[model samples]
Target: MLEGHQLLGFGFFVIGLWHLFNHTKLHALGSKSYTSTLWFPTTISRYMELHFIMASCTIFIAMELFIAPIHHQPFDPDGTIPTTHLHNFEHSSMAMSFLVYAIFAIVLDMKCTMAQHELTHFLGAIAFTQQFLLIHLHSRDHVGPEGQYHLLLQLLITVSLATTLMGIGFPKSFLVCFVRSVSIVFQGVWLMIMGFLLWTPGFQPKGCFMHLEETEEYVVKCSDDEALHRAVSLVNILFSFLVIGVTVFAMSFYLVMLRRYGGKVEYVSLVKEEHYREEDGFVKPKGTIDLENNMDDDESQKKSMQE
Candidate 1:
């Protein structure tokens, strides 16, 4: 289970990084030309991102529903859901929602209708919403130190959900894309951290330890109420530091890309010329000026000299 959380975290981190780089590059090149996309196309394949999402979600669903179960099944002899597997079912449902989103995204992209992008964004929003709901209403513990981590994770998911919904209406807004990507990165990082902190004895809080249950899952247990409080406080502190660190890193990355691509002579000159033209309330037509004709006119006599 720890490995699974880490794997999912790494996948999210990679996707988030990919989006962060692409979106920043687009904005740095020129905001006017920067249109938000739900996913980036890969050089190897246009559907690579969607394919990745579909594949990962399928694997996760299989893990939660089949491979990880005690008897290779989620249901008991009476066809009743075992209490131990409730969380697994909830997680699989979350993955299934993402799988649906990915399938619909590919279909919408292929259709190439006027509202395709908007519909894709709406689908993405729905997937995030499903993820938020599942995690928010998880059947597992939600009051312990581990729960604190999940609570913070839900906050990040909310940001992702909100930004995805906003993308439908503001598909041209780079800020929305930027925030959404960062939130995903945060979620990935936090999940990995939670997995390590809660599962690894070395990383657990001073007075906290992992307790194995009949469900074959390890839970975080603190020695006393004070220890539990201290552990939760530490999690909050870690979250604050994570926010600061990620923000600085994101802004620094943006500046670097801006300096490398945003300063191109053509882009700068075009933007400057457009600004001046708009200010002067006039636009010069594209063509060569008739200098010879102007030089032969009466208005040129005052500026011309005969040798």
Candidate 2:
């Protein structure tokens, strides 16, 4: 039952979660060298992560442009666009923006040319902004539980856009990166939730059902208020679990890296600090303390002889 959109979301989820560790460090076996970019074992592993995002965008483009269109006519014969067609068009445009971002990002990584990190962030912001606008516009057709879900998704998209824009403004802020990654992961998870809850039958909102008319396909409405409330409550619980689970997993990965790589880094740094201090005469070098003691005894013997 996994359709293109759901699969796309899962892909984005994995990729977004991967970005959560963009700053992780890993210890090299039997070496003091520590690094976080070991996914591809390349110096450009960070760029690889960005490239994966780009690839995900491409998949979205493919689904919207090539696959989804085949199932439904994008435009009526008279050239008027239906709501569904408009939604598809909006989705494709957003994916295009992401594709543009990925290209610019690769350029920035490889050549250090036009549109640096800030520009990349700007591109990401624009892409998510498109999604936010589209979701808001498309949500007009939906009401009740489905509408509420769309509203929540739009809020997330807005947060994602804000995070990217903030990243552009505060390029050096680690918090911005953290929030951005979380937002992206949340988007993916929400997409999957929407697919299972709204698209699938068994997990449909309580007392709510889907109508499959071609023009009205993928719409869910509630017949009983109580059942709908219960379903919504269940959704909230599941969503909370998802948030906690993903957060915990990300933190676990970070802690593992810290133990393996960060600890060694600290040890190496301490050794270097001591060596520098000794060189600067602030701290005596190893074995130099014994030599100094011997020198003091010799000086006392000479003083006694002089006496």
Candidate 3:
């Protein structure tokens, strides 16, 4: 199977082509909020929903990656020792993350579950990391001498994973942004370290497959191999840009929006209170009672008038 990067190149090509021919329609999907619509009922909230999906998908896919073949892929592409421990750790932690979400969901009653909130961050990191990994794979750096079939498959996985993470619904909030940013850092650092390890002098494939060499690298790298690689590169880039770039980019703007709307609401409330105070200079407090004072005042006034 294609490891990861090759799939990204393929996906990028398709997305770019889609926009070249159908940018107008795609733009509309983002331009307006549809209250009656499931996703667009409130555009921001809808995006939050999307972020949740991406996060959940990220965890699920990561889990799936670990489940088969070896029943779990080593985090390392280079068959490095670190990959095993890291992958296992992340694998075990996933169950904990699941528990956290389950508890959060049970305790709170909100439109979104805790998993969705956490996912926002988890996915954000993947957004950048995946993009970097994918591009690097297609570049001179990550590509390898493998079967074309495997190359394309890897390319597909990378793209699909990136596409899934950089999806239409990433949230504009810090929750998602922070997670994504971190993911970005981790993805890059991890890949770079592994890429270095791949070339390390001591590194040797312990498996049965490393000694074999194909007629030509079966891995169809878009950079040197096929139209498919170049074709998908653009969209994958866009996805990277959209997912990581947008999440990071839109943060300040979201803060500004929060301040703007919050100020308006506060201002309106203040104005209404001022209006009421001006209209009724000495308004009685809510639930205020003066049983003794009121009764004594009434009797005193009555006695004086009679006298």
Candidate 4:
């Protein structure tokens, strides 16, 4: 769960930064209302999305390969899977999926031109889809507030997937981008809540108790109806917090964009010819020539001939 939270929190944070830098223009920020477009101002800026994803995936891979091995044995020496390693294996698999997408995105960025952004969007959706499935499949056995939290997280992951798909179809839609960013932010916040509430000493659900054996991590189980109610209320409060956090981040980002690029002209690709220059080429050449120069040249030629 901690790994899940950290992965999602950092991934979305990077993505939020990418969207702020790449997909947005300061001109719209300064306006009372602005629409978003899919293109970025510069070629390098256009690849920020992939860079963030790749970086996040690298971190996940590192965590899985180095950090995780220290804590959990993912497989038995005989090559049989253990019940204890199920969670670890699931997380590792999810990380691998992100790594795959990141590598694919980087390759596309370097070698491919058409549908690169669209493909990235699809890949992102696939990554989220993997998480969504894991949460659904794994949480079925969880019975208490922990289960509820996983269910909520699954919903957010679903939204993340949906928004990514929508982004692929309507890459220019500002609303889609905004929703996607907010969804991710919400996921991160919820992950933090889960980490604190489920694992921390003080924040466990009111009606539930955690049991830990010598060989296993703690598992939460509900003890009474009243505790369940308290846990549900706590979840409700956490959701309210998520909403507030997203609102604050969005507003702050808007203000920052407005202040930065508000007055500048829209940035264009340096490689492409300007529209005005193309239009200039269509103008007809003048019919009036340098008749005086032509006459003088003619007279000089005739004088030479006579001489």
Candidate achieving the largest TM-score:
1
Candidate 2, residues 23-116: lDDT per residue as tens digits?
4432213223432221222476756766776788787777765577655557667778776566667677777777787777676667875556
Which model is ahead, 2 or 4, in terms of TM-score?
A: 2
Candidate 4 lDDT over residue span 34-86, tens digit each: 44432233466755665666677667656654566644446677878656656
- The per-prediction CA RMSD against the true structure, in angstroms, equals 8.1, 7.9, 17.6, 14.6
Better of 1 and 3 by TM-score: 1
Off by over 4 Å in 4: 1-4, 26-52, 58-72, 213-215, 264-307
**Residues 1-307, model 1: lDDT tens digits:** 6765776787788889889999999998889988999898989999998899899888888888899887889998999998889988998888888899899988888888888888888888888898899888888877778889989999999999999889888889999999999999988898888878887777898898888888777788989999999999999999999999999989998899899888566445866886788899976578957565777795667667552
lDDT of 3 by residue, 111-203 (tens): 556555445334433443443344344422223322222243344345435443543354332233233333333233333333332333333
Clashing pairs in 2: none
lDDT of 4 at 183: 76
lDDT of each: 0.87, 0.67, 0.38, 0.69
What TM-score fits each model?
Answer: 0.84, 0.72, 0.25, 0.71
Q: Supply the global lDDT for candidate 3.
A: 0.38
Q: What shift in Å separates residue 96 of candidate 4 from its native position after superposition?
A: 1.6
Worst 10 residues of 4 by lDDT: 32-41
